[model samples]
Target: AITQAEISVQELATHSGQIEASNKALDDIAKQINMFALNATIEASRTGNNGQGFSVIANEISKMSRSSHEMLGKVTSSLFRVKEKIDATTAVFATSHAEASRGVELGSGLTDIFEDLLEKANAANDSLGSINESIQSQFSSLANIQNSSEELATVAEKNAASANMVASVTEETAAAVEYVTRSAMELTRISESLSQSIPTAKMFDEWQPDDSNEKASQ
Candidate 1:
């Protein structure tokens, strides 16, 4: 819009120049008419009484020329004032255009800065989202590890109980073996005493204890 106003101001200045030139031409024509009127007054005076009408006509022509000259002077003065105003207006338009251009540049720069900031903000948001996902995944893995650890603890408890049962059974078997050994030694002593007290012991001498039972006792 400022550009359009500036163009219009320039066109107005051009038209003002043209109007001033035309006013100058009209002033020159008025001067020429005044000179012609003066020549006619001189000629009419030389012709004496016969030229009174010619003299009156020449005076009217002179009056009309003076009025035209005065009007032209006023028009020239007005044109000068209009030209000064046009020059001032043109300068104002030029300054406005410069300021407007600078404002546009500043606005564009601000827009670019805002866009950069927005892009960085979006990137930061994406990074935060990724970090959140990673944290969630790690939390899930930790829960799985905890479950596995609990299962391992349960299995260890069961194994310890089984070991204790085995140890108790082993102790019982050892006690039973000790009692059988004492019974076997008593039986051997009784048999030896019976043999010394009896004459038929010689016949029993051919009989022997079973080898399997002796091995088991040993």
Candidate 2:
């Protein structure tokens, strides 16, 4: 369970990093769009009567670029918060896994102790005939050991149950990480699609990294 959680965390970290890079690229492209729009507006204004349509288009483009920038900013902030939560959850899972492993070890050790106690009890019974004078006292000791063993067994059962529950929760978390990975990929695709519609976007695309590493199969 610990190993699985660790793998999930590593994948989540990689996905988060890819999303961060894409967001940065989107932001850069949006800024360039805004700059182009601003220059177009200036040139349109200098053209007198013939530039009204161009000016209106430039104004709309500027507004769109600003809106895209703001939207990306909000998304980036949200992703940061999500990454923080995932980190916290990963820490929690790691702690739980450690505790569960320790519980199993302790339970196994207790079982071994109980088996030794039982063996000793049987040996005592076998020799009871020769020591009849102290038979009652030896029987009492055997009963106490038996009772203690039962209680220890019960405790071990409870520990096993707790460990199972932790494993189940870890599986659910792994599923959530998978969902997040898909969502991040979809966001990347949408960002790319949006960029293609903007003027001079190709230049910004050229500035982006190959992204092959980011898109490698999980």
lDDT (10s digit) by residue, model 2, range 50-100:
545544544554554455445445555544554454444444434434544
Candidate 1: deviation at residue 213, Å? 99
- Provide the lDDT at 166 for model 2: 29
- Tens digits of per-residue lDDT, candidate 1, 1-218, equal 32333344456455446545644654554455445445544544554565455446445545544554454455445445544544554454444345444443334543343344334323433433443343334234323323332332333233453334323332332343343233223323322332232212222223222344335545
Candidate 1's C-alpha runs over 4 A off are 1-3, 104-218
Clashing pairs in 1: none
Q: How does candidate 2 score on lDDT?
A: 0.41
